[model samples]
Target: RQHNLRIKVARIFNTYGPRMHPNDGRVVSNFVVQALKGEAITLYGEGNQTRSFCYVDDLVEAFLRFMATGDEVTGPINLGNPGEFTIRELAEKVVALTGSKSKIEFRPLPQDDPRQRQPNIAKAREILGWEPTIALDYGLKKTIAYFDGLLRAGDGDLARLAAQ
Candidate 1:
């Protein structure tokens, strides 16, 4: 309540959808681009690390709802889908969706990699009455389609993105 500042901090999670840069280095983009390009799907660590994937549409809805809240609701709430999946699982899904011959490549785990990333959305559910509706497979299918178009049109730094 210091300074009575009006703030609604929503901790966004791994959001993926259309219009994402292929080489943004984000997990979703990395996998989708790699899969579509028939490149190795890089999975850091044993691919056991978990992450929650949220569709952009759901995140936007949460943002709108959070902003419309009363001033008293100055929440540092987590806004993301609670569904969690391992890195390997995500890569596999991308390959399957894209039907690419990309093999799963294991990379050295970054020292700062977290073992888990599923959000505790109880507060978001109770306060903002919001939760993600788009499932990972559905979202990935859409994302894969987008990246496929970009790659087919040669619209990005393919050499640079694949290097990541």
Candidate 2:
């Protein structure tokens, strides 16, 4: 306000969709790649920890909306789907969506891993009139199809890794 610079900040949450790196190590990528490869889906701890996932398209839309806002609307708003899913549920969905012959494998939780992480998108809704339109299943289907294509094409090292 003092500098009169119009600055808007957005705190984006976990996002997943097509074009994601196959081995970025994010949960969505990990699950999708492992499922596509018919490898065991690794779960940390009891797999009861929950997270909210936002489709990439919806997150991009929010970014555009936020950028187009008026100067008076400077915000550090949260931009993500408020819907949450447990890790186990996410792995199950990935397996089912990909139709992979993968099994679930549990391991000790990593240190500093949060038990639950969800966004409160109230500000984004009120300020930018934005919210995620893609459902989890629909988004996952699209993402799975993308990885399937990558595997089919044998494009990158990650693809090669996924095939094995």
Q: Which regions in candidate 2 have their CA more than 4 angstroms from the true location?
A: 1-5, 159-164
TM-score of model number 1: 0.90
Error of 1 at 110 (Å): 1.9
Measured against the true structure, the TM-scores of the candidates, in listed sequence, are 0.90, 0.92
- Per-residue alpha-carbon lDDT of candidate 1 for residues 1-164, written as tens digits (9 for 90 to 100): 68967888878888899877777789999988888777899899899999999999899999999999999887799988889899999988888888999999898999999999988999999998888899888999888877777766655666544344
- How good is model 2 by TM-score? 0.92
Candidate 2 lDDT, 1-164, residue by residue in tens = 69867798889899999988887789999998899888999999999999999999999999999999987777799999999999999999999999999999999999999999999999999888999999999999999998888887765467464445
Residue 64 displacement in candidate 2 (angstroms): 1.3
Evaluate residue 126 in candidate 1 and report its C-alpha lDDT on the 0 to 100 scale: 95
* Model 1 lowest lDDT segment of ten: 155-164
User: How close is each model in CA RMSD to the real structure?
Assistant: 3.2, 3.0
